[model samples]
Target chain A: MTGVEGYMYPNEIRLYWSVLIVLYPYITGLVAGAFILASLERIFRVEAVKPTYRLALLTAMAFLLDAPLPLLFHLGHPERAWEMYFTPHKTSAMAMFGYVYLWYLMAVLTFEIWLDYRRDIVLRSQQTKGILRVIYKIMTLGSSNISERALNIDERVGWLVTLIGIPSAFLLHGYVGFIFGSLKSNPWWDSPLMPVVFIFSAMVSGIAAVMLFYMLLTKMRHKTIDMRCVDAIAMYMFYIFIIDFSLEMLDLVHRIYEANESFRSLNFLVHTKLYFSQIILQILIGTITPLVLLFITQVVKLPEIARKRMYTVSGILALIGIFAMRWNVVIGGQLFSKSFLGYTSYKIHLVTREGLLVALGLTMLPLIFLWILLKLLPPWEDEGAHAPAAGD
Target chain B: MNGFKDIEHLFRFAGLFVIAILVFLVVRGFIVPKSFGEYGHYRAAAIPQIAALPLHYAGHQACISCHSDIQAVKSKGMHAGVNCEACHGALEKHVLDPINVVPVKLNTAVLCVRCHAASAAKPKSFPQVNAAEHANGIACETCHNPHSPAIDAGGTK
Candidate 1:
């Protein structure tokens, strides 16, 4: 048997634990974030969030549409991936991803979006032209009017879906953390706190995405910014960060308290490869800075312009920080070999299919989809305004 | 707006009708279990395998009759559960024809990877399927004994 060539054949280093794990967290983050975006109006009853509700749903749906793409692409034989369900006896925590993805896509996200949009589809089908009109017709299933009773039903159904979705969203991303945590082999990921940390960070990332998109789009439209909505989102992001940060510390503390045989190597790896990330980016700028800033704004009531700046900047940082956390978890865990004999390094490639370029492209595809979805179903329309919330 | 309201009501009524149809289909989706005899009826019509006779492995007893010591030697682990006819790929023709049948080559790694693949048992510790560590150089027979796995230890002094 030939040795799995290492540095000489970079592609042959198939199990380095760099990109695959990052992809899992990133996808789950989107699912959690998207659902949180929808929850803004549904759970909290923010009316100014009306413009963003449909957009958020579409964004979530879009990201979720591509959620399984990374997994399929990463599979050795992508074609045989569906064979997972047929043979559940071979089930692992990762195998549960297929079922989770399907439930979210089919039951929660897809159904919720369709129920919300069905009335809109009926209203807009006749007004639109060409392929979009055809799509509207198919989407509406030929209904072209929104009745009061129907709207009420939609609102009830949408609300119910949203409620169901919240737990499923947690399950979706939390399960990824569970996947990492379940692996007792990796000391870095084996903590029980992993799922909570992933879920909270997911909310932070999701809210940040919403703020970023909201700011950019409103700027594009030259529409007055919804300071209330932005501030509300920022506030939530801050709260989640506090929870996320504390949980992270709890994880570290637990690890430190135990200080197993693997501690020295893991500690060195963190101090060296992950020190800048965990200390500076995730801790100071990502968590503490944003927390203080958001806290100050929340308490003292900063001027609108200042609040906007703080929210946008903090949101962007939070997004980056969460991505960093993912990078650390995914790549960090792999740094120390199971043998604990020595440490191996992961060098990220710039151009491979599973490289940075593809990751960037996959991230952008949802944004592009959100743009088109916004155009197709402008949430600001009169019908869109009074559109029934998830779970009427 | 009043006329539009009426049209909206009509659409809602129609929508409810459509949803009712969908609900009916959903509720009706459960498959009723049928008897094996009923299954056999369908299988009898469409299945070609019914006419074929079951292939039997000429007993390992016979092979042991000639090569008793050799069978005893190989019967440690992986080969323990398996009979001589399995890897030899149906030795009926080899026994009867006695002229042209060739025993199949057993590449231990190939056979082991078939079951140990990620699709088989999802090893959470490793990220990739058919882990690169094992896929690299370790032969299946090295770690696992083919005869009787319970009895076969990794070859050691």
Candidate 2:
């Protein structure tokens, strides 16, 4: 009664999808994005991006591990989620998510990362002592042969896995888009281009995140930053970001042009309820500003330090923008009622299961995963067994 | 298979994946609902299980059987079509033990506002009101009889 305006169905007064659902897409997008970046070196032969290959893989793996957590937290009967995998409804898009997530996590990402790191794992299995040695030995899965020929097979399989990973990464995030876009029930989410937009934005966000990580990690290690690698990453990020922005604009323009029945309500939502997240955080600060920063570094011959600064700022903004885009989609979509005559609000609780604290904890959980992953199977050449270079 | 000497690890991985898939399928066969996919993707028994749930709201016939006077009053007015349980909620317990299971007093101010509140989406023919402006949170029963809401009970309207 307090927040309700105009008219709303009794059920429409409370929004089911909260910030936890917001974190769902953001995490999946990061995982998809990171895997795509790793694939650039492995599949596309983008040698300049080689320095970040293993790091990207680890980042993807870490985030992928945490991706389903939000959904688990959001469910009323969290335990019954297994029922989805057990009795997957054929007609449901969300039902397919479990299979897709597992396939990507197991069949694609873990397989590729393991193959790439297998030689190292085998080496460490022999070189390390005690408990650590046992862990590495188990990780080897009883294939301890690090012979030159065995390593050759690992490389070949890893490359093939990378080849599969590119499309798997697309499906991973594109499906997240379809979850929304397929909802003809909500005009805000209904769009044919949603998946494509999600994929490109995934690429953009993933590339930028890895770039930031690569630079920061290198600095933390007191090592020289890979200018060429970051440069190539920035260039690709800029191009993909342009495409992502164009598609989003196309969606917006189409909505405005069609001016469909739900248009006025949605338009009002974007202007009023969604002004900060959509207009300020997503478009102006997140997208355009970073695009400008990247474009500047592209045309001008700035010093490495200046270039790094620009790249850093752009990466932070890109992540924020993509997150805002997700916020606008999940939260903003629910602000207006289906009756088309009223609006409601979402207030994220503090101490509840699907609360702000859990959301924050989930966001940070990947970084902790990355830390553990790094410590266990170090991605750095000096720290871990570096997989063989591109060709034999 | 003859010259696969150095690639034993590849064979091991392939074997491992095959075993995992088999294990998953075998386990799924046992855990998944037996009647699942009989008529559709979900368990066919779900329909009957849901149908078997105990009825909470006794039909109006059961209520009017005992209290025909109230039904006569309700039937004579615009509230004739509205069911007793619509306002009284589930009455199966009340029907069984009417004396001990008396329904609690409802806040008519709140209850009446649920349907009568001004909403643009409501059909124009419905006698909706801006309840806040109309009575300033006063109980609907203060001025109007709920059974025949069109008539003012207290002669205050």
Query: Per-residue lDDT tens digits of candidate 1, residues A1-392?
Result: 13221222233234455575586678669668868878879877877666677767877877887777777656668877755543333346766777788778777887787777776777567667899888888877555456676667678877988999999999999998888888887787888889888898898887778778878888887788888777777777778788888999888888888899888878877887678887788777777787888888889967898988888878878877888788888877766655444455576678886777877777777778777878777755543534445896
- Model 1 Cα lDDT, one tens digit per residue, B1-157: 6655534533554575578658645543432122313544232433445547665567777667766665666775445656776655567666665557656668866665554556312456532235456557566556545554333254421
- How does model 2 fare in lDDT? 0.89
lDDT tens string, model 2, A1-392? 77777777788899899899999999999999988888888888999999899999999999999999999999999989988888888887888888999899988988888888888898788778999999998888897777788778789889888888888888999999999999999999999998998888888888988999999999999999989999999999999999999999999999999999999999888888899999999999999999999999999999999999999999999999999999999999888989889999888899899899999999999999999999998888767664456793
Q: Which candidate achieves the best lDDT against the true structure?
A: 2
Q: Model 1, residue A392: what's the lDDT?
A: 67
DockQ of each: 0.08, 0.56
Total clashes in model 2, counting residue pairs 3 or more apart in sequence or in different chains = 0
Find the 10 residues in a row with the least total lDDT in model 2 chain A. Answer: A383-392
DockQ of 1: 0.08
Worst 10 residues of 1 chain A by lDDT: A1-10
How large a fraction of the reference contact set does each model reproduce?
A: 0.08, 0.67
After superposing candidate 2 on the true structure, give the runs of residues whose Cα lies further than 4 Å from its correct spot: A386-392, B33-54, B64-77, B93-113, B131-157
TM-score of chain A of 2: 0.97
